[model samples]
Target: MPRALAARWYSDHDQYQNERRVIWGSEWLMFGVTAELSRPGHYVADEIAGYPLLVVVDPQGELRGFHNVCPHRAGVIQWPGCGQTGNLVCRYHGWAFSWDGSLKSARDFGDSPTPDDHSLRPIRVETWGPLVFVNLDENAPALASTLGSLDTAVRQHAFTDFAYGRRLVRTLECNWKTYVDNYLEGYHVPLLHPLLNSAVDMKTYSVEVPDDTYCIHRAGQVEGSASAGVWVFRYPNLAINVYSDGMNVERIVPLSSTRTAVVYDYFAQDVSEEKIQSMVEMSNITLDEDQTIAELVQRNLDAGVYEAGPLSPRHENALAWFQGRIRQSTGAR
Candidate 1:
């Protein structure tokens, strides 16, 4: 990787603003919110970047999001990942918050009878494809506009009909970009993926950047090879891997300069327990292969041994295209 690109990974301002513009300022971020949240007060705790969040579907069937913190003393509102609660009550001061993050009640503390100034901060939220997304930027564009052509692709491909099947979160020793770059191309599949090679036809693989913010890779069988299904990317850092019977949506979340968290979600059309488990296993094998290469690349970048490498037009236009988009998005030359 060129130091200019790698510098984006290591620079404090670049990293901070990247998270601000891409993650917090962008459209829907994948979190959980299926029929599982049908109950009145059921809620789930989620984290983005370093901000913790609380999402709930209240009695009126309306979805709401909060900062997951009590404004009174800056205490955590929900400690557990999720459960039913009559109302959101701060454990520290007994202040209560409504489903919409409005202050509902408060215990005696001082002459301030009203808690109007104390409601939990609200976040913009939207639901699509059975997954909930939050936007920390209150005035950001609607999820529909931010997604652009991706909305058509997901719908036309019938991707939303699949149900949630499995999830995996793993920590890796690499900058998040390393993982994104590794995934942008199938050039290494012949050497890195053996079991996958048995299923995926490497020669027939090709990538399409439908728009500046979106890309998809065809993972079907090569003319003389065999693969499973098509893999897709929706810009910045979301991977949509479509399998024969299901799909996996993986997102890259950076935790630090050399650390990242990979959130993998698997979904299947049919809801059989056995089928779900098998899907998870197959996805894991593919991920392990990618992780091995990503870590090596990250190490080399850290050692300052590589600056920029040439793009192989034959096998890597997809990867190069992604780099170009990053340059445009971040204003890099």
Candidate 2:
């Protein structure tokens, strides 16, 4: 019989810190979509696992990732969110960095020998289909190895050709793991997401753990449904949900031990304003239902009353696999 993770795993501060190093620090995390940085000078800046990252399209038309902090005073060089810029200039001291992360200039430091060493620290970055992923661990396996057959599985849908649609960011009052655990299984769908259950045939839902790095959730189609949809959850915190109308890539970022920020970037083949609005409304409704239960689960886990529970073998195998991965990654026996 599969078992639920200990309550402490969800609420402990030290454990959360360990997770930052063991899991988030080493995993290949999805940063954004390639379309976001389609042109030279386009950039996206954000924080993941407390580390600020900057991804940009260089003048040479290559995607690059950096630490986003100025090497001089460690001040943030780029502002948060996406924008277009010819060069990244540190507002604190006017230290300038080229698109490729080379130190272009240092204000008032005339040809200083140390300027050469002040270039932005590079982070490992790779693209899979339309998604952009970054890794802090320079030695980590290639993104393709981590993704396994996920690309082939969704290739027929031409996911890579999809255009950027919209994005929604929501801050949830729950541990990041709580949100991830809730996402890995369909056990709670009939009870937690009635609308979603009605849209997809839940009776035929199945989970496949292709490898330790990710899981694919396949559900049968309902009559006249646009598409069966493909859902992939990369270990730790990235979710790729693909529907006929569009795809939603969700990144679950930890704000604190008990708070998480969920960022969803929507992409689609045909991005009309009407389609974007409709997708937003439908996604909001589904996300509202999920947030409610995830927050409730976090509250109960903190109450000190529920230590653990047995997993439903038929419905929660994926959840068990996810918790096991956490244990394996964090060495939390």
Candidate 3:
């Protein structure tokens, strides 16, 4: 029988810090899609696990990533947003960086030569289909290796052809792991998500851990349903949910030991305003139901009434696999 993670694992600050150092530090994390930076000089700046990152397309039309910090005084180069510009100019010192991460100008330090050795720090970036992923640890395995069968799963679908429809962000008052725990299993669908349960065939639900770092959840489609959405979870915090009409990519960003930020980026075959609005509304209803139960579980973990429990071998193998991976990553007992 698989055992559930202890309650402390969900609420402990020190454990959370350790996880940040080990799991997030070395994992290949999905940032955004390639279409966002499709043109030369296009860029998007954001933070991943507190590490400021910038993704841009060079004059040569190649995707690149950097630390998003100016070398001179550690000033931020670009504010958090997306746009197209020839160079990344630091607002504090007017230092500019080219798309290839070379220092273009250091402005206003006469006779004090610009250090040829200094440039924007580079981060490892890669693309899988239309998605962009960056890894803090350059030594980690290639994104393809980590992705494994996920590539084959998404290949049959028109995922790359889908255009961005809408984005929904939610900050949940629970440990990041709590939300992931809820996401990795289908056991709660019948109890917590009545709408989802009515839509998916739970008896046909099955979970597969394709590799050490990801899980795939498959279930038979309900009668007359258009699609049986594919749910793929990459270790640490990335989820790709694909349906016949669209795809939803979820990033679970840990704000603190007990707080999490979840970003839902929805893309679809059709990008009409009416279709986007309908998709957003349906997604929100499903997410709201999940948020309620995840927060409630966190409250229970904090209350100290329950320390641990046994896993359901039939329904929670994926959760057990995820918890095991966390333990393996952090070397926690």
Candidate 4:
């Protein structure tokens, strides 16, 4: 049996900071969707994990990504969130930049010798299917290299039948790792999520990690009902859960050591109001259940009374695999 990650990993500020540098800093994280960045001036700006990201389509028909910050007094080229911007002008000052992040004009700093070139920092951006991803590390391998078997699993999905749905964001009041640990296992489903437990056959449920990079879940639906069809959780922050007629892509983003945010993007074959409501409600209920248990577990870990416990050899292998990846990345105990 493998032991769960130490309690300190959940509540320690230092451990959390270390993880931000080694894991989140160097990984290819999910951004927005390709459909949003369709037009030439279209852009999506948001703070992903800790990076203030801006991925915009340049006038020359190219997708460009930058840190969204201007080197001149750390001004913002665009405000937070997605929108259609006419030009790359700093929100703080009048300083403007070109699509390639080079300074185009200083507005009124005429002949002042301009402190440095005042360029926006650039980051790597790529797309897999309709999903866009950004990477902070310049030296990290391409998004394809990090995908592992997730590429095949997502590709084999019947996404052509579905249309992109709206995004639902939820914040969890616990350490990010605490929520993630709960996400990587189903041991609590029987107790925490009774509705989910009844919807699938508990006996046939299995979580397998064929590759260390991703985890796949298999279960027999109780009533030919469409639950998450190809439920795959890639290591770290991405989970693609496909159903018979719809699916929700989950992104786990850390806000701080004690807080985490989950972004759910639903896609459905049936875009009707009834179908959309049903899917959203189901996801909300499940998230509510998971959040309740995760937050309580986080509190106990912080209290220092409970150390790490033994993981079930049969059921918690996913948790072990996830924690193992953290151990390797952050060098935590």
Clashing pairs in 3: none
- State each model's C-alpha RMSD to the native: 3.0, 1.9, 1.9, 1.6
Estimate candidate 4's RMSD in Å.
1.6
Candidate 3 lDDT tens digits, 1-333: 878898988878889888887877788888887778899988989887677888888888888889888888888888888898787788788987776677887788676546567788888899988788988887888888777677887766666778887778899999998999989888888888777788899899888887777888899889876446788888878898888888888999888889999989889998899988888887787799999999999999999899789999888888889899888888655
lDDT by residue (tens digit), candidate 2, 1-333? 878899988878888899989888888888887878899989999998788999988888888889988888998878898999887898788988876677888889765646567788889999988778899888998888766777787776567778898888999999998999888888788887777888788888888888777788888888776546888888877898888768888988998899999999988877898888888888888799999999999999999999889988888888889999888878654
lDDT of 1 at 74: 82
- Model 1 earns a TM-score of 0.87
Q: Rate the local accuracy (lDDT) of all candidates.
A: 0.72, 0.85, 0.84, 0.83
* lDDT ranking, best first: 2, 3, 4, 1
Error of 3 at 153 (Å): 1.5
By summed lDDT, the worst window of 10 consecutive residues in model 2 runs over 109-118
RMSD of 1: 3.0
Which candidate has the top score in TM-score? 4
- Give the higher-TM-score candidate: 1 or 4: 4
TM-scores vs. true structure, each candidate: 0.87, 0.93, 0.93, 0.95
Residue range 15-134, candidate 4, lDDT tens digits: 888887888888888887777898899999888556688999998868889997778787778888887877888988788777778888888786854434567889999888878888
Flag clash pairs in model 1: 1-307, 2-307, 199-226, 199-227, 200-226, 200-227, 201-222, 201-226, 201-227
Q: Give the clash count for each candidate.
A: 9, 0, 0, 1
